[model samples]
Target: MREIVIGGAQMGPIQKADTREEVVDRMIALLQQAKGAGCDLVVFPELCLTTFFPRWYMEDQAEVDQWFEREMPNAATAPLFAAAREAQIAISFGYAELTPEGRHFNTSILTDRDGNIVGKYRKTHLPGHSEFDHDRAFQHLEKRYFEPGDTGFQVWRNMDAIMGMCICNDRRWPETYRVMGLQGVELVMLGYNTPSVNSQDSVEGLEKRLYHSELSMTSAAYQNATWVVGVAKAGDEDGHPLMGGSMIVDPNGYVMARAETEGDELIVHACDMDACSFGKSTIFDFARHRRIEHYGLICSQTGVVLPD
Candidate 1:
């Protein structure tokens, strides 16, 4: 059995006033905990290093750039990498990336057991609007801050398994998983900082929001016959609340473990990568079941067209 013990490191909120140094300290603490728990890999939430900055609108380019990292393993995050290397554990986390060419993206990276980065994924399905809107209960200016990811869905061979990565809103889209599923991915990791309540609909509460998050991940895991690890940066960030339903799902879509609180928590599970074989060879065998010829419209059109 190709078994891997994975840790879902759910982080509490990072206030705007918090420094990267301080945030890295919190992550190192979690890494130490994961080590004690015998985890081979640890997954952290999207934008794990900072507060969910997209909630506020800022016109000053310099001010906006402060939240982005021009380089990974920079001065602020080097220690976390060092710790992971010393512990001999693989880790994955999300951060705001600022390219030398002056481009920005919501990105995540995956590392091998020796702490070498093996893969990177930029978030494709960016939610919220770019422009400031008076209608929104709060601004979610992700579009204003980041360009849609140019790196399409891709997978890598790591930890003796075919693995893939996505971030936040990308989890809600079936196409995200379908692309990786077609690539024969065995494990998928994603992170999120979703609000506890819907900004557009006041009636949608925290429970319903959490339900939708689980529904998306569970369905995707079963349909693709792959294991999924979803971690969250939860609890109140300043006054805005982000929901926490961090979990690990088996290939059959059963929740093996979950976090009970919206706090800094770690959920661990021993997953056998070979367990994916049954569904992939039988029910979800794309080679035997998928009919791509009839699905031209999926790539041909971006929006719905009415029947003539």
Candidate 2:
């Protein structure tokens, strides 16, 4: 059996005053806890290093630059890698990436059991507006800070499974999973920081927000027949409360483990990669079930209009 024990390490709030070093130390603690629990992998949340900084509109470029990491194994983040290497636990976490060219992206990286970088993914479907929206309660200017991800959906073969990664708003997109699913991915790890309130439309309620998040993840897991671990950077960060329903779903779309509180928590499960074989080889098999002949409009059109 190709079994991988995964730990969904849901982080509590990262206060505005919190430093990257402090956050990394917290992550190391989670990794050590997961190691003690016999987890082969630990998945942390998006933007795990700092408070949700996008909520505020900033004018100082240097101040914003401070939030992005220039190097992966740089001084600030080295300890987490060292701990992972020592404990022999693979880890996936998200952070703001500052490329050498000075471009910024919402990014996540996966490390092998020995703490070697195995894969990286930049979030493609960036949510929020480029300019500040005065109508909303607060700002969500992800489009202003981060460039659209150049890297497409890609999968990696490591730690005895075909694994893929996505971040934050990317989790809400079906295309995100389908692209990796087509590549024979057996597991998908994702991180999110979903606010309970909809910045675009204030009329939306919290219950719907929570429901939608779970629905999107559960559907993706079952449809692709892949195990999904979605961890969240939850709790009230600088007065902005993010939803904290971090969970692990099996191939049958069943939630095997979930975090109960909006604090630092670990929800773990043993996922069998072979559970995906049946779905991929039979009912959901792309080669067998997908009929692309008449489905060109899906890609050809930008929108659909029905009769009035």
Candidate 3:
């Protein structure tokens, strides 16, 4: 069995006026912390470089474009890549992307230990409405700002492990993990800018943000029998409060390390690859137990009714 060390970075607020350089510095500092802990890989939060800008209603395309990056390792972010190479650590980080092909996406990138761009995943399950509704306390206009992700859910082999990447809200969906698990995923990395304020129509659901967040990731971990590192960009970002629930969970559905506050912090854990074998061989063994052929009406049927 192989062993790897991972670091989860729970970052603080990103003020609306914060520059890209400032965020890079924070990321580099986290990288240094990971280095001190001898981490082979580190995970950063979704749209880690800027405020959760989508919360605002902006009509100008040019103004919106400012929040998205077109190039990786551009003048502003090169130092993060350089420092990672020097530290010999692979990293998975999320950012808002404005692609060369004229598409805007919420994307995540995987960089190998040698600092090479390995794989990129764009978020597919986009939540929130595009238009603003004043009836709700806040707007989660992710769907309005970001085009639905085209990459789909995917897993790639990197760092001697089958790794997967997804953005903030993607971790909440079970299929997000199952799609990659089919490819023999050993680890899943996610970054999120979750708001403590619940935007759901039901007022009662507001208090359940932390509960849903933890339950979502724990289910993903146990169902797939894989390690999951879900990082967050928390606290007040430009007056909007972001939820801070960064956690690292094992295959046994247990959280090994979790950050309780909204600040810059590091949680490192030594992960053994073989720890998931028992779960995989039993409950999650897809080849022997899965029934893919019967799922055709997955969307068409919501509940089963029995005659009284």
Candidate 4:
């Protein structure tokens, strides 16, 4: 079976004060490290190019524009792509994109070794409310700043493995991973910018953050018999703390690699594509095990209430 080394480029916080060039430079640095370690694909954090802006309430168009990337290989980020071409390495990075059509999306892009665009994933699960809540300690304004993504969850064949992509809150939903898993995905990649504090909900922010991270990835990987790489834009950003539990889980629901203490870090693992073959042949074999024909009754209206 073909094996590939993938890296999770865990970045700390990024501020509005940081320029596009500066942030891309940090990404390039991680790519260089991934290269030195003989890696083919490297994954970066969500909105790696800017601060977690949704934390504060902002109405100015120009101010919000500064936090977005208008072009993928534009001047500020050209160097990162150029370095990728030179190094002959592929990368998947997440950011806020402002399309020429004026649509804003939370996107993750896949690039080939020669810096050619492969595919893109717009976030599916848009969390929080568009309107402001006066009672919450902080705001999760993703639904306010961005529209729901049009592209559905997708899996692509790359580097001899069936791969898929997602971003941030998408990882928390089982349907998100199941959609891709149904496509026979061998690997799934995602990046997030989750906070350490919950603003609206009553759950303890730090604990839920970590729990969701591991639980979502492990369950997805094991249930689907695939590999999941979940990277984070962690640490304190603009005074809001982030949970730093970037991790890589295998087909057996075991964590293969994990972050130590946050900051700029990389976790590299030699993922054997063969292991997934054995897994798919057993518990996760869709052709034999998945009972899609009997799923409609899951939401069917029954006369009897559920027993206590």
Among these predictions, the greatest TM-score belongs to 1
Error of 2 at 24 (Å): 0.9
Give one digit per residue, the lDDT tens place, for model 2 in 226-269: 99999999999988999899999998889999899999999999
Which pairs in model 2 have colliding backbones?
Answer: none
Comparing candidate 2 with candidate 3, which one achieves the higher lDDT?
2
Worst 10 residues of 1 by lDDT: 111-120
Ranking by lDDT: 1, 2, 3, 4
- Winner on lDDT between 1 and 4 is 1
Candidate 3 error regions (>4 Å): 201-207, 299-308
In candidate 1, what are the lDDT values of residues 1-308, reduced to their tens digit? 99999999999999999999999999999999999999999999999999999998999999999999999989999999999999999999999999999999999999998878999999999999999999989988999999999889899999899999999999999999999999999999999999998989989999999999999999999999999999999999999999999999999999999999999999999999999999999999999999999999999999999999
Give one clash count per candidate, in the order shown.
Answer: 0, 0, 0, 0
For model 4, residues 204-256, the per-residue Cα lDDT tens digits are 76877698779988998998888999999988877888888999889888999
Instruction: Flag the better candidate by TM-score, 1 or 3.
Output: 1
Better of 3 and 4 by TM-score: 3
Q: Candidate 1 has what TM-score?
A: 0.99
Displacement of residue 275 (Cα, Å) in model 2 is 0.6
* Better structure of 2 and 4 per lDDT: 2
**What ranking emerges by TM-score with the best candidate at the front?**
1, 2, 3, 4
